[model samples]
Target: MTQPPPPPPPNQPPPGYGYPQGGPNPYAQQPPYGSPAYGYPQQPQPAYPPPGPPQPPTPKGKLNAQAVIIVSAVAAIALIIGGGVWYSSTKDGRADAKSGDKNSTAGTTGGTGDSGGTGGGSGADKAPANTASKVLFQLPQPAIGADGNSATVDGSWLTDTVYAKSGFAEIVGYDPVKGTKLWTVPLPGPVCEASRHTTADHRTAIVYEPAMPTKDKPSHGCSQVAAIDLDAGKELWTRTVKSGDQAITLNNVTVSANTVAVGSTNGGAAFDISGKVLWAPKPTDTCYDAGYGGGEKLVAVRKCGAYGSRQLKIQTIDPVSGKVLSEYAMAKGIESASIVSTNPLVVAADVNYSAGDGSGISDFFSIDNKTGQLRTKISAPGDKYAAKCEGITKIEYCTKVVVGNDRLYLPTESHDGTGEYSKTNEIVAFDLATGKLDGQRADAGDGYTISPLTMDDGNVIAYKSPPYDKGGQVVSIDGGSFAQTKLMENPATKAVREVEFDMQPESAELIYADGRLYMSQVFADKPSTPGASDYLAIAYGTS
Candidate 1:
């Protein structure tokens, strides 16, 4: 094409500049005949529509230069805000992954595979209200076979013992908040069993008995009872009792303000803190289950008759002096009975036989602690199969009975016709004062054989051992409505074994002192390499 009038000079404005100061004309009318329009020259039509809708006329108070500056500043601020939101979302995702909670959904905290619930906080912020009452502490190791025998939580310190390869047990004190070992006390022998009992004021007493000898040798004797200083971890005093000629089986031991009671193959015994014998019951054929009541009386159960058709003799003895304050002879008709006492009341259970097919029966009872008198005998409303108990090898049929402050919690296992332990679930709470069933019966034994329940402030903390599973779960039952809460999952290991590879699991003994739930476990597993003695400690309030 003929060089279109040679393009205007590159650096200078196009020809026909009409305005001064090199500015475009403010008022210029276009000439006819296909020429540029008024005020400016005509450009080619745009290939696309205008970027946006036409702007409205500027307001009277608006400033053109300052407005441009403000608009740019507002745009910058919006971009900064948007970038921050994006960064925060990315950071939260990374944090969840780092916490080993990859499965957690956005906006949710803890779930089945997560350590915390949706409401869980990182540090000490009050946990989300929906979280299962948090596990204050979960011992990394199991309790059984471990050197750490008994554990008790007093204030912030958790005191326990672990066994050494040298056949001795080492006592350890741990801080629940920091998970640090506070102190340790070395013992002379391996601990067979250990328990932590508390007084009303929250003081802790740890009792440990040495393991029994093998079947080849006769039993050594009962475990020595010792009260250790909670702060010093030193023995306050040690007393040895000959519970029986055979190896003693310690069921449960409890301590009050001034007295400590130890249960063994023989009946239980109560002693003062100074190692003086307060009261020792004569050995009876039936195993004795004992608990202390307010440092004043010892509540115990004695056998009175044959297995399957046996009787229970409930007695309350004075702690200050070795004297039986009151005794009640429960007849043989009752199926199972236990001593559950808080203060003014002591509750017991009695199973009565009915005429129809042995399945028709009424099984329940309660007693007053002050008078050792029967309070109420209501017909336990449930089928026999659902209201039975386990852990009674000698006795054909039995039900576990547990006592709490306001109610009595019972778990019963019924066997199939073939005499094998079958799945039967039933938990009944009897009102301590009125002897009436509190709310409705809770079904805890279903698909599992529930053990004798434990309590902390009327809450039931017990194990549910099911078939095919080596271990059991720790469940918590609330007192207000008899609701159930699965507090923690039991590890996959048998609690008792000659040589366990995996750490054994144990249930928590709920202790509410300063608004925290304290739990302890004994871990007993063979050392992976030689030369390591098994160890155990009490872990409470997991972070």
Candidate 2:
């Protein structure tokens, strides 16, 4: 859910770091939202709304809907409940999750859970032959509550027929082409965390509360775990686990084969896709499973040691049996770690809270999942790369970083553009096996900042947020030649540009498919001022 808003004015504070540099405000919620953490003119950002204990867990939060950021004809965004963004019709609500496909695409999400990228080898994912695009739809934000809290809308999935998105307390499926509501499944409470991964059969998982929050119980605890049939618009099964008498406050959830795993400070647990309990928390005085990374394989970031001297262990575990197949321990002094890919076994960490730039990362670790051995470690100074990690507990939250074809791709931070005060960036790759820069570069040109979105087989689909006066773009970068093919471009109208650019690429969920692009938010918040505009999501299309 990131990138392309005009970079924050350089004068703003840099990304937020917890104890050392201007650290987390002691009064802040571990890390309060919009804190001085992530410097202004934000770029690819840290994972968000992080749940669980707050020890080595100081990270930033920017809610994305589950899609990409590309704003269009929004200020003219008249909310037509029946004809526009929100439709009452539920016909043809179900969609086909493209499972069993061999090729990766700019749009299809197959391997990575909600966060991983999959390639689309089909015509739907090929690069754009032209620069044609139009506004497809726009969703109005839900009226904010008195609490001024941002409602969580964490999950969004693109199936063959339906574009499923999480709403306030429901999951809504929409017609991808028309941007019309197709079907919706109501939930007891707001969504907490959604697995970025979808099964070959279109099933996924999420963690939510048992009931809506109230003043007395501001949060019921992110305790409910359920499986969703993305193609069917239904909840397959729901389950909960407890350590002693308290329901485990799950911070993250992921799907791996037939297992759905959830993790938190209390510990971790697993449920079969069918909703059967596979394992529950086994509290130990010294360690616990903090969270997991799904897709291709299931991995866990186990935290050990007491408060100030905690250590992290990365494990490739058996999804069904909850057994550790292999494990690798991080060096001492590293506070938090985020998983970039599970199969290739890549991890990011801000060693000793050193990423003062607010990207939440300082290095990348490539390891062997089978033997649990470190293969190579690449130093990515915060000032150089736009790639980011939620870095605290959610082991799988990372953005502006794409991995494929034995390579690791990262966007370079914005620097002086060829023109005036304009800023620009680049996408560069590194050999994952050797942890060395491959020297392959894809320039975002000038004034346009490019961020990696999803994969198109060996190619990569990237979003280019335009200069303040222009519209956004989606392009395909060749894995071999490093050439970019324009797929779609948004309208540059002031109404559209002003609204969408405000959403900022680093803070919105962006999903691109065929010629259509969807930009959304994981949470909807109250307007800071009276009559301020708020949008839930926006859509765009190119013939």
Candidate 3:
């Protein structure tokens, strides 16, 4: 299987996808209401106990004293009744979950039970062309308890529903459009790092201990992989995997077709959808990491030759029989390869620095799904790489650079090395048949600073946020005409005040699925009430 990019150096931590460099402190307490941090805007605080009914004015004249007395009595009675009704309402709306509890009070029922919808509003089927956005709902950071151990919550979009892990070791399903709490299922442990996949049939999740292991305390714990029936909120099956004798924790898990594959530092494992083990952990020479090639083939990479002279090898395997169908050796100077797209079977190759300074060179290849042959050598845009995978790569890039029926949608930048965007950017559609670039260059979001989110119905959903500002917007790029249309803008009322010069492009996500775009951001609105948790704002894309 194709591998993810190499991890960060020992001194630095791996950056979070769709999150800030170090990520938000899960154990950190909520900030005070109405208080702006670093000059960002504050969410309007909620009023408690509401204001009391207004008192009627007193009568000034004696002749109207009797009338005043009758009026005052009636007014007092009415106030009492109103107050009673208000109190009842508050009582009915009282949150069942405690201050430090991460469980949803409304959707606490276990196993596929519906929390029902709390209707807010629906995103319009057709929205104006302007980049106007509104918050559909706010999801609070789940309370992981006071153990100081917190799960790194990651969200996956399936159609209009979002499946996110709560800090409390539970996966909560939410409806982004209706602001509804759909369902919650407690997991046996916290999520394994970058171990989630959303497919048409089901959602795959890997839960394990301590999001990140340190030098002293490596992950000796067990990592469990489970297939979740999205609609039923039930686990199809779960298998626990150890880090092997070396304490090498599991790294990536992917589900494609009927197979679910898990990769680790030591080796990897693959299983059928029914939890049937198709292959066991083996040496890198035999199995290693694998991902879905365009069709039913599983692509895996192995190192050939001695430690120093080893070359990268790509193997195409029959996923069901676990048999290698064919193999291809990458170029002699290519050091490593990462899967860029599963549908198009695209892989991005890194340069072998030991050979020589391979600057101004970027290599991409598309494999023929059936023959496992090198189908086409996709030309990198000028001197720029289609993907910037030098450091810890983002998930956005992992699924971007799409390869379609006959065209290739690639994101490229004219300038590099700024750690932000190039001076010029374009989504170039390449004619797959000729390996030549398409003439029509589409204008992407925010110039060269935008990131590709997803491709739907032949259109690319792109995301853009101004450097150091909260004014981000999601736009759709027409696959053919290359025309761009802004779908939605930032939902946050306030943004970070300090200048974020080199903010990570994956710090936010704009997912377009089920005919709607769901936006999820780190910093968002605060819920009303003293003990209420601050929520991640969810914005919707109208038709």
Candidate 4:
């Protein structure tokens, strides 16, 4: 059964009921084809049946009243039916338009215009292909001696040249862009570690710690903190650091423009460039974790108490005064924490809580450096990546998470499916401000694992290696979309087998600055005698 249209709203006409006393309908004139008028392509007009001959005139005499009334009723019903069809079609068109808008916002698959494939198309997720330049230069092997550690070198990128800890007694500099030796400076002892930092004037300085002596070589016992001016190619200052009566063996060195932080086993100290002691380790803190300094502030972690029930504290200090400006204690169950970044500080650690699936989880926290307040906390996925990696040598795999430039990247391990325990490292990025996970995860293909080395210019450089494979390749992951791309390959490293030793591959000591990657290939295979592998700093272009 058909029903008449409903009445309109108060003071409004019914749908399609209003009409003007006009000569023609507004919609009657559509553009013609290929012409501005009628708006349709112009074609030869089609022939229609010729108009019928003029109808005979009706009789002018008085007509029957019943016939007139029936004709008028039929006309009104026809107008109402026509108007109903037009109104329904218009409403449907509007609904379709709204649906399209929502899909665009939610992210559509197979969308047009170069959108990334894995997650929703984001402009930032575009892969950085063809950004690496040709291999600039290959570093020569370091000179060797009777001691095995004498030939090992660790390299870091400075402003223009590559600074390296060469043979225990000297720092070597190389011209990466020009493929030439820059300068070399003699040290008091073998340099076991080196870190390059910038001063207030942007001059480069290499802060280093000498190697500890073995029982066989008592003469090499060294506990000195020294600095070398990379630009001037000379030693700036050197001083013996002592804790009580024993020499302090530094674990790492963190540097800023005006201050240098020397991290040790139980405590650490901060000093100025001119060998002035600015601060020393406090007695309350026990073991000190890694520290990082930048943008006029330094942040670090300190832990105390027993291993089972320990407390981890975060401290931010004024780089110039060495005063602890702010300190905050992490929530309970935070097993351990690493300072992933200093500027707009972020930390990554495991929260010892069981999930709904009965697995485990990890989280990254963004902290306010000034107020010691936690800003945001983002939870990680349960892909067996948050498992405790005790004794893992690769810092990127175990500790060196990164947060910067609007993204927080963590190296996570995933099952390879070939064996019950076989896994490899992959990078997962999150929103730094909100701690939301991006849908995509960056990988370095099968049989190869990726370890993050540095992040710059919306890209992250990772060292990619295969188990029991020699050498490694440098790859880049787009921070925005998590797309992976290969940048460079090095064929110098030797295959390190885990079957025999049951140890993770030793990390390739490396650092990046000014669009270049500097690596000290200590385990690389040498062409000559057995167990006499050559080592040197190799520089590669990243952007």
Best by TM-score: 2
lDDT per residue as tens, model 1, 1-543: 676445333322223222233223211211111121100001111111112111222455321110000000000000000000010112101100011112211211111111100111122222233422333333443232332322211111222221111012445555544445555655443332332333332223333334323334222322555554444544455544443333233334455555656654344555554444555544322334333333224555554333334456666655555355566677763433443342433433434434122222244446666677877665554444233321111111122445565566655434332223334455666676677766666664433444433454556555454433332444566667767765544333333211111212211122222223333323233444566443332322312
- Candidate 2: tens digits of C-alpha lDDT, residues 56-147: 11235322111124211010000000110111211111111111212211122233343342223343676555677888888777653554
Q: TM-score of predicted model 1?
A: 0.49
lDDT of 3 by residue, 1-543 (tens): 998767544332222222223323311211111122100012111111112111222354211000000000000000000000000111211111111112211211122111001111122322365556555555555554433332234434343445343333555666657657788766655443333244444444443443333345433243455555556665566554333223333444555556655544344456555555555444223223422321223566543332223356666665655566666777653434665554456666544332121212255677765666787776564355333432111111243355554676666643332333323355667676567777876654332345555455566656553322244555667777778877765443333211121112222233444335444332222223668544433444443
Sliding window of 10 residues with minimal summed lDDT for model 4: 70-79
Candidates, ranked, TM-score: 2, 3, 4, 1
Ranking by lDDT: 2, 4, 3, 1
Please say which candidate is ahead in TM-score: 1 or 3. Answer: 3
RMSD of each: 37.3, 12.7, 19.9, 34.8
Candidate 4 residue-wise lDDT at 122: 21
TM-score of each: 0.49, 0.79, 0.62, 0.59
Clashes of 1: 32
Residue ranges of candidate 2 with Cα displaced over 4 Å: 1-124, 144-149, 528-533
Better lDDT candidate (1, 3):
3
| Candidate that beats the other on TM-score, 3 or 4, i.e. the better one | 3
Off by over 4 Å in 1: 1-168, 193-196, 200-219, 242-252, 263-268, 280-297, 303-311, 332-337, 342-364, 378-405, 409-428, 433-435, 438-523, 527-543
Model 4 alpha-carbon miss at residue 215, Å: 5.7
- Indicate the residue-level lDDT of 230 in model 2: 71
Query: What's the lDDT for all of these models?
Result: 0.36, 0.65, 0.41, 0.43
